[model samples]
Target: MIDLHLIGIGTGNPDHLTRAAIAAMNAADLILLPRKGDAKSDLIDLRRTICADVLTGATRVVEFDLPERDTSAPYLGAVEQWHDAIAAVWRGKIAQHLPDGGRLALLVWGDPSLYDSTLRIADRLRADGLAMTVTVEPGVTSLQALTAAHAIPLNMVGAPVLITTGRRLRAGGWPAGVDTIAVMLDGDCAFQTLDAPGIEISWGAYLGMAHQALVAGALAEVAIEIIEARASLRERHGWIMDIYLLRRAVPVA
Candidate 1:
């Protein structure tokens, strides 16, 4: 049985690598890194830098082409197909490199359990009759980076926080029971669709990196500011990974 490790490397920050994640990387017989093409080559470079900085052993580092989901298909369906393709790639790599079961590691952008499909793809291998054991080394998430960049608490005192995607927020609007919302995977400023007048937004782009940009103010006031910031950052960097926090501004008594 192959022992697999999914190590999370937080938001492109080399310092965000936990001791356990470093240990996992050094311990692996093979480490797989994915390339997402030229537009976002920085992501690929970041993973390479992390590997160079951390691996002390002879762990073989391998690079793989990440499969892009077909946009024409429905979102969920495309994602499912994409995961299957990624799993196929993984199976090929393991078979070619380690025909005999051994320790393997893959660096995930963030904690695999949160909004990542690495674990889900790993399951496909098991279903395909490959004997394997999986372990996860959690790392800092974008949500953490977002809050840290903004210097704000993730949640208000004793209040719930709804962590969701741009699509859901655009479709559902502000959910009930929680004034605090952490929006992730939001390509479009979904908050623009909200009727939230008294809401406040703290937005960050390229978080945890040198070119980090942040904008914060009342939602109605800075909504366009964030939109423009996001567009400009994407153009400058060729890619942007951003997240934002929203809450109803507390009225002074």
Candidate 2:
């Protein structure tokens, strides 16, 4: 049986790695890292750096070519096919590296439970009738990183926080009953669609990395500024992973 460990390395910062994560990596027989391309090479590099810094044993490190998701197809359909293709790659890697059942580890960005599909891909292996065990070691999420970087609480006292994406926020605006919203995977900066007055925004790009950038102010005032900064940052870095928190102004009692 293959013992697969999905360890969350936390937003590309080695410093964010937990003791349990380090222990899991060291205990694994093989660690798999996927290369996403030049623009996103920093991601794989961060995993490598983490391995180099913490892995102190004969644990083998393997690099794999990541299959790009075909976006031409419908969103759900494309994601399904992409997950299947990734499962095939995982199968090949496992068979080639460990003909006999052995422990393997994959470093996931942020937390696997949040927005990431690594667990889903792992589940595909089970559907394919492969006998393997999956275990998750959670790490810091981008939501936590963004909030901590800004030194702000995730929500107001006794209030709720809605965690969503740029697409939903744009398509459905902000949800009711919650003044605080955390958005991820928002390449389009959906906050611009909000014409709501007195909305406050705390936006951060490349959170927890060396080139991290943060901007906060009233949404109406800094919406344009955020757009310009995001564009400039993406142009310079070639890729950007950003998240933002939105809060509607509440009147004083």
Each candidate: RMSD to true structure? 1.2, 1.0
Question: Which one wins on TM-score?
Answer: 2
Off by over 4 Å in 1: 250-253
Clashes of each: 0, 0
lDDT for residue 124 in candidate 1, whole number 0-100: 97
lDDT of each: 0.91, 0.93
lDDT of 2 by residue, 1-253 (tens): 9999999989989999999999999999999999999998878888889999999999999999999999799988998999999999999999999989899999998999999999999999998898989999999999999999999999998889999999899999879999999999898999988975889999998889999999999998899999999999999988999999999988777
Question: In candidate 2, which residue pairs get closer than 3 Å at backbone N, Cα or C atoms, i.e. clash?
Answer: none
Worst 10 residues of 1 by lDDT: 244-253
Per-residue lDDT, model 1, residue 9, is: 93
**Model 1 C-alpha lDDT per residue in residues 2-101, reported as the tens digit of each score:** 9999998988889999999999999999999999999989999999999999989899999999999998999999999999999999999999999998
TM-scores of the models, in the given order? 0.97, 0.98
